[model samples]
Target: MEVIVDPINSAVETLMSGTNTLFILLGAIMVLFMHAGFAFLEVGTVRHKNQVNALVKIITDFGISTIAYFFIGYWVAYGATFFSGAAELTQNNGYDLVKFFFLLTFAAAIPAIVSGGIAERAKFNPFLIASFFIVALVYPFFEGMIWNGNFGYQAWLEATFGAAFHDFAGSIVVHAVGGWVAFAAVYLLGSRQGRFRNNKLVAFAPSNIPFLALGAWILTVGWFGFNVMSAQTIDAISGLVAVNSLMAMVGGTLVALMVGKNDPGFIHNGPLAGLVAVCAGSDIMHPIGALLTGGIAGALFVFVFTWAQNNLKSFDDVLGVWPLHGLCGLWGGLAAGIFGTTTFGGLGGVSFLAQLVGSLTGVAIATLGGFIVYGAVKQISGLRLEPEDEFQGADLAIHKIAASSMDD
Candidate 1:
């Protein structure tokens, strides 16, 4: 039989693939733009003297993360190295290339999260070096296990628990891991200069509320793409994911307002906590479930942030990223199981035991990785600035420029 080549069918396939590629590319750009949000949030939260350093660190980390992820991290996570000619790479309408870009944005978030926690005092070069390793190895190992099912982890989980670990977008994989890792860095770096004086807590006010609010808004807007676009293909897209994100955002905002006593910082960060929590089960959970999960996350951020700062004298997490990303990420990871079951009006394909084990696994890896990475760097090159330099602020100490020096 002579098979006739069908041009029309081939054309349709090409169009659909092209459309999916465009969708994911846009999502990657949106997530990439959230790095600006991360920068501004740090800039606003830190003192004016550290503002310039805050902005510089995030952008610099992004550049390094791009290099690391492109050359090494991508291969580690998906077993697909980009060591081929450009023509071969562009064959699938550049779909694989764009997918790398999207996933790279996610991997880069680790340093961005760590930057906030270790703000104002870290040596820039050492932090960058640490971030390079994290992107290249630490983050990708867990990413491959959960997202790509490397090393038979997913299969083991499925066989043991009747359901594999389910992180629809990366609550445990990205946000939780980033958060916990940041905690280790913060702990190792020690409290900032004058953050605790004679056993007294010193409050360094945020430099710019408007900038912080702006950052929050930008992150909130960009998060839709982060959650919904995880579908990665047109056929898998779900409006329910979008709606769940919206509900969770609002739930978090309201709870933060109430729990934080209307504090503007908490108010701004509220939506983010919610969005972080909802990321795990946005696909399977109902909007109400997402709302509940988000509300709890917001409350946790407000309360844990306050408690951690007050009680943990050695720890000085500048933007409360530990609570927002770490603890809330754990909650989100587990919440997926509670809210994603058929009994809860969700599309069921989850196991709570699987979630607990997987979430704990992510935590263990992140904490160990963060401690090992930061500890090694600390022992070798040191993590913090000198007392005099720290007192002078990072902008002057490292960059030789203050945020504003009109008189100079």
Candidate 2:
């Protein structure tokens, strides 16, 4: 009887571990699918001649990002290395390995975000080199500091502010960092050749509205996995997170429709803006709080994007990534502290002061790292296509094929 009981207990433990591994694997796949969303979003936004380049850049960046993260970035973030025998690597149902896959998707998002901002004119291989360094070094550094408490950052925040900084998903860690880093790249690359003429802005229409809408739809569906799976285990999954994400998405959609005056681009991106903001607080905030946070983000995107496109002459961000991801992400980070308090109908145990400091710290690190990586790459290899190449389009110039050919 004793022998039978022991065997049963061992089997139970093994079953639980396997279940967790499967859960995380599915989540990783969903987030991996979001890269397609990123690709299509950029492809639809850029001009027709550059569509192939957009598709190529996103998939290539993911490949490079995986190599960088698997060999270096994961170690930098968690101090865990996969340099082990297969038997050892397969222990615990390979949950650790699957976890690495999940986080790598997040890290890869940095290049995908930047691709949109610097689309049209950026040199292909040079930007890929910058992406390698960013994923391997810059992103994982902040990820470790916040999520793992690598130094004493979380401890210090809790002691001084009455609570640790809380980012349930990665509003500050992933989105804001990706956004600000994109701002740096966009600034350094400067406006496209015809983006400004005689001190006035020029508008470039999207190549395909249906494709843009499709991209938005895919991201919206995949985001549930992004926000919910950050739990990293089945036992911790929350209905609250799902509900809050829904509310925020609706809020963003309604506001963007009104504020953007029914513009198709804004309409599609509104839900994405809302999702970005809700990622931080989705687990803790009440649905209403999430709604307000999303609504504000939607309005912010429309107004800021319009103003920047018309007024900002120094840089051209084709996708308006800074406003949609960077600024909205910063707001989401702060909103977690505001809405994730008992006073605001949340579970509490978050500090506004800690959130502010943490949010600002992420922005600073990303900005400095972006400039260093991109600036150095620019100095060494140059950042953009030649004038002749620009006229010919990246597909023909770099890839030696257009997205479509009349002869074919």
Candidate 3:
């Protein structure tokens, strides 16, 4: 067969062909591996008896998210919009399907964050049901309103503030949403047994710091795709995004070492803090700015984690999502406003006030939304496991299998 192609048409066709598609596919694969990292990290942080339960929750979330996101989540989130200049794109049904698949992977990541919070004690059936609600209904609603252009508060902000809100990689949309959900789940679940006694918090140390470290490393690698792939437009911006991500990770690790004084937990979490912090501005900030953002994020994680452990009461956030994702995501959003350069499309040349407002808005919406949804769920069916189940270990109580027993 002889192929005939116009020069301009051929160029555009090539841009959308083999190379770009492969890059997108590779990015998806990297993000997918992060689920494994989450499983290891959650299992390592919880009691040995609860390891299987935590693992099951992680696996179940990944599976459920894939299906939920494919069905209605993708369409609702990215379907149509007259705002953010996405009206034209959404008008055509054909292109909507393409955009749906491209964005669904990111949507799936939100529920994964919620999984860690409900670990160790949540019933698998309820957790699975929640996963569907988060990905299919909850997550898509937010994604549609914020990033999708037509439905979110961003359009109002753009109209009222004279500039659009920014979230280069989903600092607010993905991380904050997940963190809020985690907070709600933990709040409803209550403190683990003996976590608070005589009005003092008891620490439950990580069982395998090595596993946590390994998981952190894997997540760090996967984050490159998470941030860079958001550009959609392939160019020098992608390379810059990759570089900024690496530098931020380095900065975060160095900051952790300086503050932690040889604590493995600090080292493991530092890189994650950096990655999350940089996500909001990875494509817009200078390399030096990326480093500073990461360093601050690392420091924040160290401080916040310690504070939550010593001062916080009644809540045990098994995997530290609030500090890692919630706090750092906030930092990223604000940093994009402060340190972003005109060399890239950032706040139309940077506006600290604007960035602060955007970050704060994201935080408020995510937190309130989470509390409402989780509160309703609690009222209806209750969110936590039975106290006896918690004491006996969720694996045996809920799944009727123990980690050791499985091996035997």
Candidate 4:
């Protein structure tokens, strides 16, 4: 029988696919914009002398990340390549291409997170090289393992545990990985000059509170897209994710306000801590569960940041990425197991054992990969600015211009 294709049905399918492509493209843009937040946050935190370097590092890292992920990382993660001709690539409304764009934003965030920790003192070239390797190889390895189910890791989790590991929007995959990787780089880079003197902590006040607050606000706004758009298709979109993100954000903010005693930096970062925690389970979680998860993350950031600053004499994490992203991301992973279960008023498909194993595994891979990458780069090209150069600040030393021309 000669069958006539339905033009209306074909049109609807095209529209739907086109809509989803637009949706993810917007998500890619939003997350891409969050790099500005990362820049400003680091700019505000580091001394004014390094402000120019902060801005340059984030944008440059993003550029390098795009190149690396496009050339290599995308294939590493999903076994897909863009080497196909434009005619083939334009198929399916170019949804696959936009999907790659969306995920590349996530992969780029690793270097952005590490940039904060190593700000002011790191050599620009070596860090970029390390970031290149990380985005091209290290990050995508774990990313494929979890998100694409490569290497049978997810299968192993399901077979061994009651449920497979769950990270709806990459609490462990992105944030935690970035955080722990930052920790390794920070450790290897050592404390910034005079961050400690004779076993005494020296407080470095933020250069610009307004800029810092602006960064936080930008990140908070962009995060809704980050969480909600992980669905990647219009049909899979969930209002529940949006509401959960909102609740978790407020929960984190209030808790940070209380626990941090209204410190502006802590207050601003609170919502981020919450958002990081909630990303793992926003789809399945009750709003209240998300709130508590975020609240705990906020408090954890404040406490761990304070404790690490005071106790870890050799470890100087300038923006506290370790606590905010790494530890809180880890907590979010575990919290998914707790809050994303029927017992906790969630949809129920998470295993605490799986979470524990997966979270720690991410931490391990990121940390080890960070050390190996940074260590090799450090030995070969060196990681830090020279003492005289560091003292001169990255702005003058590397960029040869201060944040303000008047300073010249």
Give all TM-scores, in the order shown: 0.98, 0.99, 0.88, 0.98
Put down candidate 4 lDDT per residue, 1-408, tens digits, no spaces: 124457777888999999999999999999989999999999988998999999999999999999999999999999999998999999999999999999999999999999988888999988999999999999999999999999999999999997888999999999999999999999999888898887789999999999999999989999998999999999999999999999999999999999999899999999999999999999999999999999999999999999999999889899999999999999999999999999999999899899999999999999999999999998999889999999999999999989987746
Which window of 10 residues has the lowest lDDT sum in candidate 2?
Answer: 194-203
For each of the candidates, the C-alpha root-mean-square deviation to the true structure, in angstroms, is 1.4, 0.9, 4.5, 1.4
Q: What's the CA error at residue 155 for candidate 1, in Å?
A: 0.5
lDDT of 1 by residue, 10-30 (tens): 888899989989999999999
Residue ranges of candidate 2 with Cα displaced over 4 Å: none
Over 4 Å off in model 1, which ranges? 1-5
Query: What digit string (tens of lDDT, one per residue) describes model 3 on residues 183-207?
Result: 7777777767788778877778887
Q: Which is the winner by TM-score between candidate 2 and candidate 3?
A: 2
Looking at model 1, residue 396 earns an lDDT score of 92
